[model samples]
Target: MDDRGGAPAPPEKISAVPVRHPGRWVAAAVLLVLAAMLVHSLLTNPNWKWAVVGQYLFAPRVLHGMLLTIELTALAMAIGIVGGVIVAVMRLSPNPIVSGIAWLYAWFFRGTPVLVQVIFWSFIAALYPYLSLGIPFGTEFVYFDSNKLVPIFVGVVLGFGLNEVAYMSEIVRAGILSVDRGQTEAAEALGMTRTKIMRRIILPQAMRVIIPPTGNETISMLKTTSLAAVVAVGELFTTVQLIYGSNYQQIPLLVVASLWYLVLTSVLSVFQYYIERHYARGTVPLRARGFRFGRAQGGLS
Candidate 1:
């Protein structure tokens, strides 16, 4: 109100103006130029041998190699996930001996490079020439040649699978720990056994945390299968190497392998996105629950 008591002066209008940063425009322009230059280089470079890449992309040998790679990934991950859950449970066991054993297993496997494990397994026959199943040292039973019992592919799977078990166990343990302690208490109050509580009550809820990283591990395993090539496993990278070795088209063959890996990883990523969204239901905000690679909405903060 005015001191004159006639009428209050109208409120002053705010002439708000937005601040701008010209540097952002310059940075964006520079990035666009760099991106265009990269694209031009990829298209114009004859040494890339895009035409050769196309020729072998779907060749019979390449396709076979791709199938083998997929099989190895699936088999290894299957072993990993199942063994992981068991080890995770053991790791969290109330018994000190059990938990200690589990910890030792993880320590040994995770402590070593996967490549070393692969090489060791491939040459395991050198150390143990025969694998025997019997009643310890007291009684002898049938024995099989180590090389026959553990084929090259089998050895590779064992290496990848055992190493993965160590990692997946940690992932599972973290997920299990993420579940509220109150939930376990409530289940126990209901007279549920530990195993029952884990299987029915805890694990289902922990899956929300478990799935995302598991998917990432699966994708990583796909690439790690390339390490199997050292033992002459006919997986994708091995097959590519064999082809390049014979034809001397190393770069082109390498490109083909990279393309397949990219495609497989992309597919896995999409699956991971959907699985994450599934788990995120009723948890994440509607608009924010999207593909991991999705751009953020709204203006710059």
Candidate 2:
């Protein structure tokens, strides 16, 4: 017998059976029917012009366009990532001025439409004919023609990257907030500087929260590259648009572009899954095993 008490009362018995969900099967059946209808329509539709889709998919111009889209996405995402980190840190600053500046930047960029921003950058020369690097109210050290320095490709990249920076900053700020505040206090107790604390203690933990959304943003950015067509930059969608414009087979050309975008996104999704898995150490591992076909252990052991 224990000194203060005897054995505790037996725990209450509860049934472990899961709730039946027959409506789920009904919903799945309805969804399958809808999907079948969609597939049927696509297959039977003559205007799709599958032959044309097949013909231009491998065209040299199309391939070059896709390469440029890839480049734009990569460069823009890089800027967003690095700038987001700086802005997020600023957002977390104790000083109101620093945080206010960050807020202003995030607010203005995010509030405006990305297309407007793109057009603005494309014609920035109208606002500032020359970009000068010099001491304020002192010597002008360098000057470059805005029109030359900010061409179509440069404008598009700057547009995508700047827009991404605002969104990414919020993503990063949320990630930073997800971390336990106690960790910061603990690092401080250990005499860690703010920079070291962030580098070693905070950012690593925040990455788990940050990565999933970043993957989503990357996929969105891939699609958003289509907007570059407005600026005369020859990204994938632009190439498809030009082909269709020339041949007047708009549907099929668009379909080819959609197929290529699908392929690229699928590849990026696989990469994102592996990256998530890598960072998921010590947490419950995600189901990395994709669907496998052709095998089943049938006999009862």
**In candidate 2, which residue ranges exceed 4 Å CA deviation?**
1-26, 285-301
> Which lDDT tens digits does candidate 2 get at residues 1-301?
4566997777889979998999999999999999999999889999888888888999999999999989999999998999999999999999999999999999999999999998898889999999999999999999999999998788888998999999999999999999999999999999999999999999999989999999999999999999988987899999999888989999998888999999999999999998987777767523333323443734321
- The local distance difference test score of each candidate is 0.93, 0.91
Question: What is the per-residue lDDT of model 1 for residues 154-241, given as tens digits with 9 covering 90 to 100?
Answer: 8999999999999999999999999999999999999999989999988988989999999999999999999998889999999999
Residue 21 of model 1 has an lDDT of 96
In candidate 2, the residue pairs with backbone N, CA or C atoms under 3 Å apart (3 or more residues apart, or in different chains) clash, namely none
Best by TM-score: 1
Off-target runs (Cα >4 Å) in candidate 1 are: 1-11, 286-301
Per-prediction TM-score: 0.91, 0.85
